[model samples]
Target: MLQKTIHKSVACSGIGLHSGKKVRLVLRPAGENTGILFALQNGSGRRFLTPRPESVIATGLATTLGQGGDSLATVEHLMAAVRGLGIDNILVDVEGGEIPIMDGSAASFVYLLRMAGERTLSARRKVYRVTKPVEFKREGKLIRAEPCDGFHVDYTIEFPHPLIGRQSLAMQVTPQSFTAMLAKARTFGFLREVEYLRKNGLALGGSLDNAVVLDDYGVVNTEGLRFSDEFVRHKILDFVGDMAVLDAPLWGSFTVFASGHALNNAFLRHLWVNADEYLEEVSLGLEPVAGLEAEPGMVTASAAVLA
Candidate 1:
């Protein structure tokens, strides 16, 4: 498949989740292989910040990617929107430390791209295809990627809160699936977290408007649930967003259980440095498949069985 980018530049303004200040952001088309880069408007004229798994510097209420003298916080939502729209090349210009928490979901980003329209380029998309298996673990929380027909995630999350016990979602990644199924799932946190953030001078932009906040017993939001599994759904959504840091689109089968930013970023780091383990440059005529029983028309498994 060919690389894609936004046809026209678009801009929006919103409040930073942590900074609690209004920030302006512009989305511009980038050349092939540019990946998704952030350009800081500190008067240096677009200092670029590329998302490598190792750039993940913090995982407090949100994920932050950083390098010396450069950092971008709360990037998962924006990244999810980019991945969801299938935009392979783009430049994100931001005025603050983090992207705005527009509605606490990726839906706004989706709307922005739709309004700007999309243009496919002549260059083929670079894909990080999983050619083998790789895994990461920490204290029983784990993330694993195995060879698959296409990009897919089988994720599960658990919480002590009665409202968010255990939730799981497994889906093949596609523009359609991402928009309709994953993009609207809102980010969620506990009631205590909000107070803690405010006390520490964090999440200044947080409100009932952007995130799903739960007290000891039930949701504090009047709107109630968007999906029955919105909690786990949001986790999977964040994974899709963070996976965008791979630079190239990815094709793999990942099964994660009780995973979070730390484990997810760790898993990505393992996949990245060990490129020899699970990286492949492949072409596609149709949407890539996430998992396949065996190579099409191949009898390798049957041969082994007979042997």
Candidate 2:
């Protein structure tokens, strides 16, 4: 497969999930091998940032990347959109300290990226293929990964709330699957938690419009859930975004159970420490798979097995 970038520039503005302030984001086409870059605009100039596991400064409420006094917050959704769409090179311009939280899901980003369209680059795509199995566990939560030729995930989430007990989703991630099945899943939070965060001056912009808020009995949002198992689908979306910090596309079969941002980053750190033993950098030769060229808009079965 060849590397890809946007064909044109696109921009949008929305409320920040944490800052509660209006923020603008612009997506621009980048040159070959540019990878994903973030240009944080301030009064004086722009400070560039590259996402990395070690650069993760905070993962409490969201994944945050920082260097020196500069930090970006709530970046996971946009990152997920970039990776999920199979884009390897793009420039993300931000006018604030964070990307705008659009409906608390990747659906809006997906729409924007499609509007910008895709352009194939000259360079072959770089992929980090798992060569061995690795498991990271904390308390009862765990993330297990094994060798695979493509990215796939089997995710399970459990909560004690009456509306959400246990939910699971398994699928091989592809552009079609991501757009059709995962992008619309919205982030969710408990009503009591939202109240506490608001009192503490956090998540000031969060409301029913962006997130699926739930009380003791059921979903407080009038629209209810986007998917029957939206919670697990969102977890899978988050996993895709967190994995993008590796700076190369990762091809693995991952089984995750009740893992959050902190644990996900920890697992990535551990994997990086033993990268040579567990991972290998491979290049796709850009050859089309046999007997699969004529079918447009069809994701290969190997790349989109859902359960």
Candidate 3:
């Protein structure tokens, strides 16, 4: 599959989840092999960063990438959007330290990307294929991955709350499936946690408008759930975003259970350290697999969303 980038530029502004301050995000098309670049706008200068497992410094309120003295928070949703849409090269400019938590989901980013349109590039796509089955476990949380030609995830999440018991979802993550199934599933938190965060001066911008707030009985949001299993769907969305810390798309089938950002990044770090034994880099030739919709030398935005 060929590389891809956005056709044009698009911008959006909203409230930061943690800062409760206004932030601006600009999405610009980039050259082949540029990968995903974050241009942190400060003063009249910019600090560029490429997301990597080692760069993730915080995963408490959100995934925060830190390098030198620069940092960006709440990046997982936008990263998930980029991964879901399959754009290989793009420039992300952030005026504030955190990405805008639009509805606490990836739908807004998805819409922005689709509006920007997708442009195919000349270079062939490079991906890391899991060559051997690897399992990373902590307590009861587990993440198991095996070699696959495409990105797939079978995720299960369990909460003690009545509103969210055990829920599972399995899918081959294509752009269509991402947009239709995962993009709209908002992040969720308990009422007590929200109250505590507010009292501690954290998650200042978080509200029912962005996230699904659950109480002891059920959802506190009047609108209710987006999906019957929205909690698990959101977990799947987060998993996609967390995996994007890898420079290239990871081709594998993953089975995840009760795993969050911390465990997710830990697994990636483990994979990176043991790459020679468990992973192999593969570049697709200029030939389309039979029955695929795109051309021989091209990968559609929807088909190559993850890898």
TM-score of each: 0.90, 0.94, 0.94
Query: What would you estimate as the lDDT of candidate 3?
Result: 0.89
Candidate with the greatest lDDT versus the true structure: 3
Q: Using lDDT as the measure, name the better of candidate 2 and candidate 3.
A: 3
Better of 1 and 2 by lDDT: 2
How well is each residue in 1-307 modelled by candidate 2, as lDDT tens digits?
6788999999999999999999999999999878889999999799999888899899977899997678999999999999989899999999989989999999999999999999988877777878899999999999999987778899999999887899989998878788998999888899999999999999998989999999999999998898989999999988898898867788889999999999999998888888888888777764453433323543332222112
Give me the displacement of residue 137 in model 2, in angstroms: 0.2
Query: What TM-score does model 1 achieve against the real structure?
Result: 0.90
- Which regions in candidate 3 have their CA more than 4 angstroms from the true location? 288-307
Q: For candidate 2, give the lDDT.
A: 0.87
Superposition TM-score, candidate 3 onto the true structure: 0.94
Poorest 10 consecutive residues by lDDT, candidate 3:
298-307
Query: Which regions in candidate 2 have their CA more than 4 angstroms from the true location?
Result: 288-307
